[model samples]
Target: MKYQQINKSLFETNRAKFTTKMKPHSLAVFNSNDIYPISADSTMPFEQHRDIFYLSGVDQEESILVLFPDCPKEKHREILFLKETNDHIAVWEGEKLTKEKAFETSGIKTVYWLQDLGKIMFEIMTQCDTVYINTNEHYRANVETETREDRFTKWLKNKYPAHAVAKSNPILQRLRSVKEPIEIDLIQKACDITEKGFRRILEFVKPGVWEYEIEAEFIHEFLRNRSKKFAYTPIVASGNNANVLHYVENNQQCKSGDLILLDVGAEYANYSSDMTRTIPVSGRFSERQKAVYNAVLKVKNEATKMLVPGTDWAQYHVEVGKLMTSELLNLKLLDKADVQNEDKEWPAYKKYFMHGTSHHMGLDTHDYGILTEPMQANMVFTVEPGIYIPDEGFGIRLEDDVVIQKSGEPNNLMKDIPIEVDEIESIMNG
Candidate 1:
């Protein structure tokens, strides 16, 4: 792993929370993600399955975590099946985690190789009455490729047809949504690195700078800070390119008097930090530009305050729509009639601010959380609001990750990253 070691207690607490929700005598299994193939002899980088990573703190491939909390044998209560390491593997590939190291990393006492998984699982299945199968259940999930979890579930169901099946996704959705303190610390580490990258770019960006140049600067900073790659696809959009919400084609010059929309973040130890900020190529916002920019900034500030304990995700967006509506009115982009006749599903604010105001943030940039449920403390979320004005030849967006609090307001994780116009301008010019 490129990043520093995460505490095993985080996984221990996560497993306790998950197993508490399981039916008595039920067992849950989590599989590591496959190293997907690109072509013959080529494969994408390995990423640990979030479910397994959440439960055991094991960030390796060919691993499985079986939690049979009510197992007859206490040693089988929490087991880890890892890929067997050998001298040949050490010479050819690299150091894989040995049993002792796996125990140190995961806090699980009993560890076995993948070859022993079937035998142990058979014994476990015969002892347990139900099995929890992990599945991808994020609301925006559109996975066309069958994942390792899918394959495991298929085989497990076929092999143990008599066992009662339960979905691990539902239990995980609620449990993972509420962050542990250690998980919050890891996410904050990612955000802190992202802040460093953003500040580096603020100094690097100037007139005539190409979009890809900015992207390179961010990656350079992220790598030096122990990040593997971007949290998601980066968008280094300059001028009108900012209007395209998912713009990633970074192949244009940043003209003076225009703004660059940097939608980039870092991935530290599989945790994500999402941020978006528009900056001037000339290190100063024009009168009209500053008005729109400050409006979006105000919206982001107010919208984040809505992310507190017990806030409804749906209701929060509606309130944010009203705030954006007023901002658009002030920006002269919308009138009373536009809002009066606007469809309830798609409000007039959609004309300028087309995307959702925020989403849950943590492991995945759009991390899993039950949107239908009320918000809870320690749940991290991104409060991003933007106004894309193609007609005006520029767009503005401001994003910050925040942690929901029990009182007052949410705590902004990106608070150290400069967002104020004066501060950004000063740093850029200084």
Candidate 2:
């Protein structure tokens, strides 16, 4: 991992929180993600499953974490199974985590090789009455691939059919949504890295620069800052391309007068920061562009304030829609008649600003959170409001990650990053 080792206390706390919610005599298991294949012998980069990383801080493939607080044998209560490492394997690949190293990485003392998983699991399965299986239950998830966790779940169920099955998603969804102090710091580091990348591109951007060039600049800054990669697939849409909400074909030349919509962020130590900033290709927004940009910024600022404790996620968006509607009206994009006659299902504001204003942001870009529940303190959310105008030949989006506070407004993590038009223009021109 490019990022420094996280404090084991954070993982220790996370495991405690999870285990406290588990049913008595239940054991919860988390598996590391597989190194997916691109073709023969060539594979995609390995990304540890966020659940295992959250609970055990084990950031490697072919790893497992088992939490059994009620186990009769004290050593077997919390265990880690990792791929065995030796001198020969170290020469071929890099140094994999040894048993000692695993203990240091995760706070758990009982560590075993992956080869012994079946034997150990069989022993534990007999002792426990219930098995907790991890599953992807995020609202935004549309997974089609069978993950390593899924295979493990199937195997466990087949091997121990009599054991009561329980889902770990509900518990994880609640626990992971709220940030611990250490987790908040890690996310802040990611946001700080993103700010550097954004600032770097502000000076580099100009007429005739390709969108991909801007993407390259962000990655360069991120890697140098210990960020492994983007939090998600970056969107470097220039000009009309921004009208396509998820446009990622960053191949076009940025015209002199066109705007570039940059929906990008950096990931540090598996934590994600999501940010979207649209700026002028020529380092100066035109009169119309400035007006639209400020309007979107206004909506973002107002929406962020609504992310306080006890705020309902669905109602927050409705209120944000109202804010956007007012902005669209002021922009002359929507009239009184348009709003009055608009369908309740899809508001008139949808014509210009369609996507949701916010989503939970943390370990995953669209992190885990039960939207039906009220917002809580320390929960991180992204307030992103965009105005996509195909007729005007540009789109404007401004986003910031914020922590829900106990009182008043939420704290903006990207506060140090440039957002104002004058500030962005001054940095670019200076």
Candidate 3:
């Protein structure tokens, strides 16, 4: 891990929050992500499952966390299972976490090796009547590949057929949505690293620069500041590429008059910071580019104001669509006829601005938050509004990470990062 150790108190608080809602005499288990394969004898980088990482601050592979609120044995209530390491294994794959170190990292003294998982779980299963299983129940989830957690869930159910099964998604969705103080600090560090990358690109981006060069600048900055990598696949779309929405083929040369849409973020301590900024390739925006830029910025600003307590996610996006409609009307992108004749299901704003204005952002880029529930305090979100015009050969979007406050206005984490046309222009020219 490139990042520093997180304070274990945060995990302690998270466990307390989760256990408070668990049903009596129930045990919940979280599994680490499988180190996915590339081809023969090679695998992608290991990313700890966010749920496990949230409950226990262990950032390692082949780890497991068990939470049993009604355990007869006090020491077994919170336990960690790590991959045991020996001299030969240590030389090949590096040193794994020892029991004492796992205790310090997770604040859970009951630690065992992965090889003992079956016996330990078997003993604990006899004491509990109900088992809680984690699932991908987020609103945006569309998983195709079976994950490590999925396989464990299947085995646990079949092996313990007599036990009553429950879903952990509901409890976790609510708990993980709200950010702790420590969580907010880690997210801030990610945002700070993203800020550095953006500032560097403002100076590096010019006419005829390859789109991949801009991507390289961001990677360089993130590594220097201890970020493992981008929180998600970055979108360094230039010109019409930005209009494709998820376009990631950064192979084009950025032209002088074109606008580049940067939907990139950095991950520090496994927390994500999503940021989007559209800037001119030549350090000066054309008149039409400036018009669209300010319009998206306006929508982004007004949309973030709606992220307060009691606001519904679905209803909030509906309200944001209305805001975008008004801006598009002024931009002449949608005429009175287009507004009147458009289908009710898809508004006239869809012609120019198509995606949702905001999504919950944290551990995962599209992190956990039940969409049906009302918004709550301390929930972090990204307010991103874009106007993509493929015909015009340009696109613009402005995004910022914000913390929804208990009252009044929400706090903008990217407030110091350049967003305004004047602010971005000044930095590019500096």
Candidate 4:
């Protein structure tokens, strides 16, 4: 792992929280993500499943975590099964976790190799009444690939059909929504890295530079800062491309007087930080561009304050819509009649600002959080609001990662990043 090792106490606390929610005599299992293949002998990079990482801090493939809090044998509880490693294997494929190293990484006392999993699981399955299966139940999930966890779930159900099946998603949804202090610090580290990348680009961007160049600059900064990769596929959209919310082609040449929308972030210790900043290619926004940019910044600032505890996720967006609507009306994108006759389903504000104003941002860019439930303190969220004007050939968005506080306003993680017109202009020209 390029990033520093996280304290095992965070994973210990996470496991405790999850196991406490389990039914008595129930056992839960989590698997690392498989190294996806592209073609024969070709494969994508290995990325550990966030669920398993959250519980055990195991960042390697072919690893499993079994939480059997009520096992008859005391040592059977909180077990980690890792792939067996030897000196020969270490020399060929890099170092895998040794038993003692695994204990240090995960805070679990008992560790076994993967080969013993079947025998050990069978012995424990009979001792437990219920088996908890982890599933991807995030609202934005559209997974089609058969994950390692999914295959294990299928096998477990077929082999032990008599055992009661339970869902771990609900418990995890609530637990992962609220961040641990350590997790928050990791996310803040990711945000700090993103700040460095953004500031780097502020000076690197210039008219006639290709969009891919800007993307390269960000990756360079992220890699040096120990972020293995971006939190998600970055969007280096320039000019009209910004109007398309998910623009990522990054092939077009940036033109003078055009705005580039950088929807990018750096990940540290598997925690994510999401940020979007739209800046002029020539280091100076025209009068009209500044107006739209300031509007989005104002909305972002106001929406962040509303992320306190007890704020309903759905209602908060509705309120943010009203805020954007007023700004749209002032920007002359909409008039009184446009809003008055606008359908509640698709308001006039949708013409300019189409996407949601905020989303829970942490482990994943769109992290695991039940949006229907009320917000809570220590929950991290991204406050991003944008106004896209295709006809005007420019769009503006300003975003910041913030932690919802128990009292007062949320704390901005990217507060050090330049956002104001004067600040950005000064840095870009400096």
Arrange candidates, best lDDT first.
2, 4, 1, 3
Superposed on all Cα atoms, model 4 deviates from the true structure by an RMSD in Å of: 0.7
Question: What's the residue-level lDDT of 144 in candidate 4?
Answer: 91
- Looking at model 2, the pairs that clash are none
- Candidates' lDDT values, in order? 0.92, 0.94, 0.92, 0.94
Off by over 4 Å in 4: none
What's the TM for model 3? 0.98
* Candidate 1 residue spans exceeding 4 A from truth: none
Q: After superposition, how far is residue 278 of candidate 2 from its true place, in Å?
A: 1.0
- Taking all chains together, the TM-score of candidate 4 against the true structure is 0.99
Measured on C-alpha atoms, candidate 3 has an lDDT of 0.92
lDDT-better candidate, 3 vs 4:
4
TM-scores, all candidates, are 0.99, 0.99, 0.98, 0.99
Residues 309-352 of candidate 4 have per-residue lDDT tens digits of 99998899899999999999898999999999999999889888
Off by over 4 Å in 2: none
Note the residue pairs that clash in candidate 4: none
